[model samples]
Target: MKSYTIEEINAILKGELIGHTTEKIVGPEELEKAQANHITFIGSSTYAKLWAKSKASAAIVNETLSVEPGDDRALIKVKNADLAMAKILELYNPPKPHFDIDIHPTAVIHASASIGKGCIVGANCYVGKDVVLEKEVVLYPNVCVFDETIIGEATVVWSGTVIRERCIIGSNCIFHTNVSIGADGFGYRPSDDGRGLTKIPQIGNVVIGHYVEIGANSCVDRAKFSATIIGDGCKIDNLVQIAHNSVMGRSCIMAGHSGLAGSVTLGDGVIIGGSASIKDHTTIHSGATVGAGSGVMNNVAAGQTVLGYPAQEAREMLKQWVAMRRLAKK
Candidate 1:
């Protein structure tokens, strides 16, 4: 375990130290479990009250907190204690992965593929013909990179993930287990004979921008013609689906089981709550939020929060609920 003196920690967090700057901190721990030599934070009022009794040698707190007189524990006051603690935790971050052999012996790499320095290709991972993997890319077991696909620098793809042909993944992205990028979109036409459905081939690819994180079991389907784009800093939760031709802007977030149908567009910072579903070809403007389990069948304007089936503004939906309750009592 690594250790830092309270003085060093204070310098790192840029916090005002109230007392005993020389106490040693070994690690960060939960408030209930923290003891001497461990650093913790009080990010909420509930936790703030508990701070007086916590066994931790020091705490990260806001400047507004009042330190009781005669308490021996040191206090580091910052503007946002939670954010400060995040930085403090990063100080002891584990080293990035490195291996003696860049490519695992069990991994298959095509001769035509271009792999940059510091790449780690794990067992059973396939690098198809003409694939390009930039520096420090880590492909965990059973990751399959299809032909002509490109993965940018410092990207880590976990086990059982597939990147289909011609897809582009940008730098510092993370694809969790079982993520499927560039899968054929669901498109079909009724057969002339009225007996079967004819498939429409998905001819395009998926473009994942920098700093994207797609959680386990999520899928981004390939566009019918142009690229399906996931903008920079977007976070897609587990079991989410981004359908054909959907374009998401920077920092958009989709919670678990949320889905966007064909041709849907999301502007910057749009948030889709858990189990929300957007109708096909819908446009959700910047900073809009869709409430949990809502079915959005129309466009959501910029900075709006929508809720309920055939989703409406949150306040309107609440008023409807109030009216419904009054009618039920009658």
Candidate 2:
């Protein structure tokens, strides 16, 4: 366990000390799990009460909470205890090194491809013809970058991620394991014989903007002509399906298991809860929050919060529900 004195921790975190600054802390643990010489945190008064009985050497506490120091424990007050904990973790956590930059002997790089400096291409990875990978890109084992794909600087693609032909990923993006970008959209047309399905060729690619995070096992499908675009800072959770021609605005959060059909547009700062579905050609404006399990059919305006199947305004849904119950009682 890494140890730091209370005074040392205060200086490192720039936190205010409420008790003895000479105490030594060995590591961090949850309040319930903390042992002697460990520092813990209480984000709320309920946890503060629990912390009073803890055997921890020190506790990070919110400023508004009243803490009576026990003989064995001291309090370090901060504006936000959780944020302080995050900062401390960031400071003390060891850095993860990028894999050494070398193409494995088993990997295939086309002669026409361009790989920039400090890029690591792992075993069985494929860099297709005309592909361009910028500086500091790391591809874990068995990644496949298809033809003409463009990956920008400082991108880290975990193992088994497949970038289909012509996909364009911007700088500082992270693709977790098993992510598939620029795959064919779920588009099909009825056959002339009316007996079979005709696959529509997805000729376009997906454009992923800077600082985007695509979670593991998620898929972003390619468009027919235009691109499916995920804007800068958008965070897409695992198992998400972004269909053809969909446009997600900056900083939108699309939670796990959510799906957007073709041509859907989400404005900046939209928050989509888990398992939500946005139908084709729908639009959701800025700051709107779509609750979990929602099926959004129509458009949602800025700052609106909607819920339920064929999602309606949250407050209106509650009011209607209450009225229905009252009538049922009658």
Candidate 3:
């Protein structure tokens, strides 16, 4: 086990120490589970109130909170206790899985495919004709890169991911397990004979920017005629669905189970909460936030926050909810 002295830990956090201690802290733990050698964090008043009952020898406290070190306990005061705890956790994080810089014998690579220096193609992986894997790219087992696909440098694709033909993936991106990129859009029309539905041809590709991380089982569909674009720094959570021709700006965050209908446009820094569904052709402007479980039916202006089904302004929805509750009491 790794250990750090009180002074050494304070130096790492750059915090002001209140009361002095000579003991070493073994690791971090929650307030309810901390022991004498463990450290904990008090980020809000709720956690701060529990400090007196905790057995932790030391704690990282928010600078704005009024918490005193009792007896032999020490307090390291910082601007944000949660952020400080993240730094401390990094100190004790375990090593990640290592991949050797070689292609597995079980993997198949087309004669025309280009594999860059230091790339790793794991077992059962497939690289098709005219495919390009840039330097240091790592593809885990069973990943499929179709013909003419371009994967940028240093990108890591996990198991069971599929990049369809002619798709463009940017550098340093992470595609988690079972992710499906460039799948055909769900477009259909009535058949001329009035017997069955006719499928619309989807011939476009998916273009992802750098530093984006998509969670497990997410699907980003190909466009009808152009590219489905995902901007840099966008973080998409697990089980999400992004339809065809949707354009997302930089730093957009989509929580788990959120979905975007066809041709939906989102501006920079937009946040979509879990299970929220945006209507087709709707535009959500910069910094707009959609509440969890909301069904948006119209465009949202920049910096607005919408809530509830058929989502409206948050304040309006709250007012309606209050009135309904009062009416029920009568």
Candidate 4:
């Protein structure tokens, strides 16, 4: 029940307040559920219309909003209310420090491993032989860091994450729950007797760069010989599958369920929508946007927006659909 006066909140956000000064605010929440001590925000005029009925004690409203504040609630006006609210929320509820100065008793760190200073290994977490976890790394419960794996400083790995052998993850990265890095790639050869498949040895590992955020259940497969690399600031959504030897450039955004096949290369700032699948060895140039449900079979040029199977330009795909409809009517 931590509380801050409205004046303090205004100072925290550097925002100008338009209402009562002595009101106390605690945490931030949605307008519908925010109690007397909670502050909320309304970004658009559509939500501004509902301000009269909101239970929030205070609101961060954009300058353009014309809604009259209720007698019971206070309004703080700012240039970008949403951004201002985000800042306010950060001040009110700063992220809790996860890594303590000492490792938990249940954590298993091999005697041969080298764990750097300020690392927090949570309950049931395993740090294998020769593993290197740099300073300020936080591993949640049930995390497994395999042999020779190196996690850079200030990285936080959530529960159930498995960083396989020889993987190299960079600093300030966040991996959500169930993330699997450096897993064996889906590679196999026909057996000698023509009866079964033989697994190809995935001798390489995964390299994730600084500030990368991989969502829950996402997997980055290990390569056959080279690294499966994800560059700095890349954001991969949940359930995405990045295959062996795939190289994703900096600041790439991959939505949920997108699958990148082996050896595929995505240039910087590429945007892949949900459920998109790129063919093996394909190259998507910088700033390309692949629409949702696209099945990309060929290369996409830089700054292009592609859609549909064997993805074409979005407008072109729509035109082809129109032509197909007319032909079907014939």
Candidate 5:
């Protein structure tokens, strides 16, 4: 574990410091468990009492705290305690991998694939024909990118992930383990004899925007016509399924096990909770929030929070829950 002196930390945080400036701060900990060598945080006034009893040698507090004369541990006062904690964590962050050799010898690249400078293609990775991998892109072992796929700069695709043909991946995007991008959408029509289903050919691809992160095993299916789009800064949790022709606006978040059916349109900053299911052709306006396990069948207004099955407004849903509990007393 790395250590920083009280004075050294004060210099880094650039905040007002109180108490002894020589105690060696090793790592961060919660207020209750923090030792003399650990740094703790007080984000609210409610935690002030807890801080007084905490064993931490150093603490980060927000602007609301005042200097206490009796308790004299090293305190760093800042505008936001949370942001300060993030900076402190960066100081102890693990080292990144060094890619001295750009492409591993075991990797297979087709004749027409174009790999940019400083890119790292790991062992057993497959790059298909006419694929374009931009500078500093990293593909971990067993990753596959099909023909004509264009991966932007500094994108990282982890092991066992697949990006199918003609998909466009933007810069600084992360596709975690076993993610499936541009797979065929679930589309079928009844056969001529009405005995079986006929598959609809998914001719379109997926287009991902910059700084997006898709969690492990999540899948974004290809479009039946144009692209199935994931907008910039969107964060998708594990086991999320985005079906054909679904278009999400920037910074939208979909929690674990969430499903968006084909042709769903989500506006900017829409937040879908865990296990929520949106029906086909539904539109969720900007800044709307869908509660966990919700079933959305109709269009949602801007900035609304919908909850429960056959989703209704959150406040109304809570009232219904209260009424149900009252009736259950009988």
Candidate 6:
């Protein structure tokens, strides 16, 4: 286990230290579960007020919060308590799963495939014909890279991931277990004979940008014509579904179970909350936030916050909710 003195932690966070400076912090823990040797964080006023009763020996507190250290404890005041806690957690993070630099004997690599220097292909991995894995790429067990796919430098793809043909994955991207990239989009039409449904041929690929992290079991469907693009620094949570031809701009976030329908366009910094669903062809402009469980049925203006079913502006939704509650009481 790693240990840091209060002075050392304060120096690392570049925070203002108050009270005892010699206490040893063994690790970080939740505010409610912290012990004398554990450090916790206070990001909100409520947490700050609870610090007096917490057993933690040290705490990283938000600079705006009015808090003081308890007897024999210490406080490190930083600009952002959450960010400071992230840094501290990095200090004690365990090592990732180990894979050797060489491909495992159980793996299958096609003759035309290019495995880059320092790449690790784990057991049962399949690299298809004409595939290219850039330098330092790591594929965990049972990963399937389809024909002509290109994974960029330092990308880590975990077990059970399937990258379909001709997809492009960017450098430093992380795709967790069971992630499916470039699956055929859901498209069908009535047959000319009026006897059955006809399936639309999806020919396009998925293009992911650098630093994007897709959580476990998320699916990015292949486009019908061109590429389904995910911009740089986007973070997609577990079980999210991004439909075909959707274009997401830089730094956008989709929480767990959120879904975007076909041809949806999200501008930079858009946030889709958990379980929210956007209608097909809807455009959410930059900095707009869709509230959790909202069903967005129309375009959202830039920087707007929308909530509720058939989601509208947050203020209007709240006003309607209040009015309905009052009527119900009567």
Off by over 4 Å in 2: 21-27, 92-101, 322-330
Residue pairs whose backbone atoms clash in candidate 5: none
Q: Which pairs, if any, clash in model 6?
A: none
Worst 10 residues of 4 by lDDT: 93-102
**Each model's total of backbone clashes:** 0, 0, 0, 0, 0, 0
Q: Residue by residue across 30-79, what tens digits does model 2's lDDT show?
A: 88888887888889978988876687878888989998766746788899
Query: Candidate 2, which ten residues in sequence have the lowest lDDT sum?
Result: 92-101
Please list the Cα RMSD from the true structure of every candidate, rounded to 1 decimal place: 2.2, 2.4, 1.8, 3.0, 2.3, 1.0
The local distance difference test score of each candidate is: 0.92, 0.90, 0.96, 0.91, 0.93, 0.96
How many Å off is the CA of 160 in candidate 4? 1.4
Comparing 4 and 6 by TM-score, which wins? Answer: 6
**Residue 77 displacement in candidate 1 (angstroms):** 1.7
Candidate 3 lands at a TM-score of 0.94
Candidate 4, residues 57-109, lDDT tens digits: the string is 79898988886666656778889987897788777676765555368898999
List TM-scores for all candidates, in order: 0.91, 0.90, 0.94, 0.87, 0.91, 0.98
| Native-referenced Cα lDDT, model 4 | 0.91
Tell how far residue 60 is off in model 6, in angstroms. 0.3
- The 10-residue segment of model 6 with minimum total lDDT is 94-103
The whole-model C-alpha lDDT of candidate 2 against the native structure comes to 0.90
Tens-place lDDT per residue, model 3, 199-287, is: 99999999999999999999999999899999999999999999999999999999999999999999999999999999999999999
Runs off by more than 4 Å, candidate 1: 21-23, 65-70, 95-98, 325-330
Candidate 1 vs 3: which has more lDDT = 3
Candidate 6: segments with Cα more than 4 A from true spot:
none
- Model 1's number of clashes is 0
